[model samples]
Target: MTRWLGASEVAARTKSVMKTTLRSGTGRIHFLLRAWRPISSHTSPVDSSDIISAVSPKTLQKGGDNGNFKQDFMKLKQPRSSVTTVLQSGNSEAQRTSITKLRRVVKKLCKSKRFERALEVLMLMETQNKIRMSPADHALRLELTIKVHGLLKAEEHFNQLPNIASQKASSLLLLHGYVKEQNTEKAEAFMAKLKGLGLVVDPHLYNEMMKLYVATSQNEKVPLVIKDMKQNQILRNVLSYNLWMNACSELYGVGSVELVYEEMLSDKNVQVGWSTLSTLAKVYTQAGLVHKAFAALREAEKKLSSGNRLGYFFLITLYATLNDKEGVLRVWTASKAVSDRPTCANYMCILLCLVKLGDINEAEKIFKEWELDCRNYDIRVSNVLLGAYVRNGLLDQAESLHMHTLERGGTPNYKTWEILMEGCVRSQNLDRGINFLNNDFAGLKCHD
Candidate 1:
């Protein structure tokens, strides 16, 4: 039986032949490989299959047969006299035309998702007439490689390009991908390398990282990034302010959330509108600070009155809490209660309280008649109210509500999920339980 070489063997063979022709190839390859460590981070039960595929032969190809390759190597081992004999007989314009055609083909390939094909074109162009891979070109190749096949093989191509000013930004993005698996330390090290190159880490980069950390609930990391933002003189955009505020709320509860509110409010250069108030209002309510929550609710309402009404849902909660039936009814009626209505915690609270008072008739009427009251809103409240129904053994209502929640562009969050899982256990909804257990809730993209 003929033994087939492993992927690494193929890559090594191809890389070896290619490296021999280029002076700085080894250094470039090393830098690229180190950069890919971020996104390919897997520390658990090591997977050999992934390794094999990562080191696959896509980035390399044959220059010649083994026998011919050895003969060419023997010839190349000695320095030849500097002669331009090819130009004396060959059509130079033909070579240029061929290279131009390859460029067009490669450009189109880049637009499509065929990364390996594009790399093939580049390598082929290089083989015909040594094409220098610019930093931008290398970075593009690295990005596509990682996006299509994972981070394993991206570095191989990345390292072949010389480090230049143009490569700086693209390099950071590649490094960002490396740390995409939430590897903070490695990402920071890569970020520092950019600093060594005289590129300051901007607030947007920090914000992007902050989002990743927040998703993993590493809320404590928010402060350090905030410091980086300040040092870089990167102005905080609305989203950055929102993210920092969110981090504060997660850690210090309402106190930190309020502090963010104060910070946003103090910035005359910045516009602290609906989203800021919306976030703070939600945090205050969740932290059980009804008074402070209502204060945020009022702040939202004032700003919204001048044509931005995104915070209408938050206001409904404050009104619902105080049992201000008129305030709730007034807003509901003013909108004709048909096409537009705010559906957040406040509305859900009203529904829950109405049910608690044995006013099932009115609640059902709202569910059936005031259908648009469940406008495009966050799904958390629906899940929360559903939890209340589950506790009280309101089976029929919970079932209908759950179905409606799904229908109205609401994907269940972890909180909603835990409640459903518990209900499934308590009510013994076996089919629902099995289905829920097997469901890929996290994969549900936001349609809203």
Candidate 2:
């Protein structure tokens, strides 16, 4: 027979185990398996999923009332007022819904930058329900509050919740907010407080501190963060290694960066990904090691996952930076194989790379291809070729392209106007520039 542990009992044991693991050089796999074990030595532990299944399946299905709740939440235009009214409008099902379901909804909204709505949902869940708010929940609300309001308001909210201040999650969120604002004094002070409380057991906390150092151009402090992680026996993740390598590149040059890379490769836990290789290539390119950069890029290509558009974009841009036109074309061709039809952004990326390489003829061919495949006329796409013409002193071609875009129902944005204004000034056409600024496009500023 198995017995289920109370939530509080499980949480206490987990926290204690985490602290113990932090002090020891325990394997991450071993630590993770031990972290959630039951307090009892004899009885087997019942899984939380099984408990949820036995209790009430309809109340929540894996942190939600299923997909319908998310769809309904998304349809809410005025979530602040509507969320509470809709949820509490004599709907017994919603009224009886679990906090986990509500928290998941809040997270979904937050992920989409709908912080105002997310905050509202979280507030409603707390005020309307009898369910207890955990430390993680408090942390989430802190993050949302920071996004919706600011750090001051978020701190006020955090201070009001005295119980959560001691928890790792909320404190980490506050530190993250401090880091995001680049508040060095507050971040360092708060970090010291967290360390004193023994809440800095996780590598994520150290990563956040390292990120703050890097962001504020305090690159020398990054290695110190790695040292702290080592002292604390916290296993460093990929982000940790990446940030350390970047700081090394900026402060110590390519050789030091390569040394960091070598250390990361030897680490049994961290899987070396494409982005890491790309970073190496970037560092090599910046140091003027063309052969080394090419070698790194080739390795990066093999590391790239299937259908990764962003990875191809990085490779294409790097190849262009290295003036390897063949490499750029090759990556672009490979990129097309990943998708049935490339996105407008993909077309734009390739166009920019081709234009940078001074392959205007190739760019023109791509622009035509985009024209044929495009469902909607995108003015931004035309601006790429138009800007290329203006930059190359082809004022006539620029004008023709502008007129062509106008005829195709493409509306000119501020960028398109700015390009034309720049072209006019370069060609000594003051009257045309004035006309563009005044009559043609209202509120268009003349470029100097």
Candidate 3:
């Protein structure tokens, strides 16, 4: 009898290990940093060009008489102790130039999504220079931490920030992290602490709190937060109003939604966008105001200019929720005509709608088309189709699709296996169930 760990259990264990690793490794400079030394008085000034040329592939390949590329490559890749020493030993102007070049390289790496290397460069700059980073720089590091590590590790890093680096920007980054994780309790506590410290609470922070409240199903707290924002003289933005209306639509009814919409229109700072109109349409549909909903959707479409794939996708989603299949197709077609090229996300939206409408054939067609053109494959799209097949009792199709995905070098995630296992169990296919279990065990062993 093999036992499989549930998703929650896996998540808990993963978080535990991450927290342990973060605590142990926090504030520890990379081993490579120890090798770096300030330049000596006897050494000549290290030119920026010298640094560049030293690491160049041509220089590495020419290191030996025999042109030993491997040895040269290894030397180039190894961190040079003299590199930092030379930078720090230079005159003020020379040092500034070196720092500037390093900063540019760091920025480029970050833009290219090479966050690990970016962080290493940042750490080297901070450790070697012994200069306090700007508040904005600290905030950037905080965001990068959240990106490279998970929220738990990010929060630990936030707590370790020096007092000077702990500004509103850093606080907001942590608050946003908590909101994203939907840790409402932690968000509220952090907010209270910030207020206790008499820190300036921006309108965006209040909006994030409202979002956290809404995400946690505590919609009643939203209006209270909005009122607090007003009392504090923080002008509400369009997103603030939309979140309020969404909460009201869920909690009160269409009447409350209309009142908020009216208030939003009156606010000088609030510029109602397509999201606002879409929110209204959703509320109207919920209240059984079918005609009003359609009108709102039309207004939303009118507001969107050409090449607005997201806006069109939103409209299609709203129509699909109302079971308007024709409306979904109409907007999707119109979107294709105007947009430069439909994104994977756009195709995903329409495929989901088709599946929801029980139009599996169309969904399959769209999925195949996306497969042909999508440069970056998304597993969620395949999972959606798999879900539809399983729900419709097309177990054979689901199994075939799963195998096909595996053959294409696509790794099936936990949800993929879960769905197949559930389908097998429900259909009383014992052999298939055993096969899925065996495959899952094999995957676990491979991971180990």
Candidate 4:
């Protein structure tokens, strides 16, 4: 008979086995596989694909995902080769005015992700006004800030620009700005504008903005959001329910979270997925309502057994949180049974978890596996491995990973600099770290 491991005993067992891999991008978390009693000794270590079937009597489909960013955001980068007109003959004042106008347009184009247009405007001014344009002037600072901090902060500064740029800023632009400010009033006002204009905010917008107000817990907006679905004729898609479900989980109980989901499920128009269920389950786990969480998982299993492999992962997370080693193993084995084609993220999570668990053997396996998987993902994966290696005191590996990141047409960000610098300091390799910062990072910042 399989050993029945209790919650309290999980930590003891996990002292040597519990692990969480820090994946590169996708949220696959490697955790303790509670039921996976490593039976290299057993002739059959419970078929992974079989247990997965036990959860759902449906079909099993295998696939892949974009390694770093979300699938919806993974367009490839293309280069532009247009030559610009130069403004070398204009007088100083005229040149400055022309350059300033060009600079404003450049910023506007950048905000719209129309980098080509911005560059074009800059070139046009340079060619016509006889003045030079510098991408260095607050361009990198603003660009980096927007990419790192996000569209919201960028919008504020973007909004201050001329009408052309402001017109280019979409609801995404405004929503991002509100999210960055983290100001409820601004967030609500912006959302209200979207609603007033008869536009339904996307799930992403609703979550970011709603998460802010959930703390107030007055939450009268709950029904209104649902009401907006009918009023505005949006079917309250999975993301819509998720934002509200997340809120209910925080303010009330799993019952509240389930209520919204249940309502959605009853509606023939609303289609939910395992991801939504997992997100809802997370709230229950966080609230210490494990029993209810389990029930929800079972429900998900029933609904999506033949659909997605996320069920096994959700169970792994739940068991990991509970410190249930056997349970974690069970889920891991089940997940693997469905497909061995793990994403870079899944490998990363497993690696981090093994590291945390001090299961170096498992961690090494994860690292090796991820090394192979990272090849397709380019710099993002390399950077993650570099950071992980540095944290684990593998200096050689970190250096190699850093070099690999550059080869993939991706520049290391400030976070990379800080992590490597700290790694160097710890290893007492100060000069090398300083050299990197001075020669590489500093030069990279020259554009700033």
lDDT of 3 by residue, 1-448 (tens): 2233343443343443334434545434454377444432223443454342334433222222223322232233222332354244435554554455455555765887867655555655555554446676677777877887677877786777777446666888889989988988889898988887766456788888988988899999999988888888888898899899999988899999999999988998768888899999988988889999999998897777685677889999999998888889888877876747787678878998999888999889888987888776666678889988888888778867865665454555667767877776767766756754653544533332
Q: What TM-score, over all chains together, does every model reach? A: 0.46, 0.75, 0.70, 0.46
In TM-score terms, candidate 1 sits at 0.46
Residue-wise lDDT of candidate 2 within 99-198, one digit each (tens)?
4456677778788876777776666555545546777777887888787778998878866774634366688788888998899999998888878877
3 against 4, candidate with superior TM-score: 3
Query: How many angstroms is residue 417 displaced in model 2 relative to the true structure, after the best TM-score fit?
Result: 1.6
The regions of model 4 sitting more than 4 angstroms off are 1-169, 200-208, 211-224, 230-233, 298-316, 324-345, 356-358, 372-448
Name the better of 1 and 4 by lDDT. Answer: 1
The lDDT values for all models are: 0.56, 0.75, 0.71, 0.52
* Candidate 1: tens digits of C-alpha lDDT, residues 1-448: 2222233442333343233324345566778677443232122333444332211121112222334332332232110110111112245554344334445545665676545555544443333334454556556656766766676566554555456654564666666675578777666776676667766545656676787778778989887888777887777777888898889887887777777768877877689876688677778777887787767766765566534333554455456665655555555444343344444644565566555544555555655553565555456656656776767767556766765665565555567657766776777656666555444232222211
Candidate 3 residue runs with Cα over 4 Å from true position: 1-86, 89-91, 108-117, 127-132, 145-166, 181-186, 196-201, 305-308, 337-345, 376-380, 386-390, 393-429, 432-441, 444-448
Give the candidate order by descending TM-score: 2, 3, 4, 1
lDDT of 2: 0.75
lDDT of 3 at 69: 27
Question: Candidate 1, after superposition: displacement of residue 333 in Å?
Answer: 9.8
**RMSD in Å for all candidates:** 18.2, 19.6, 10.1, 21.4
Candidate 2 TM-score to native: 0.75
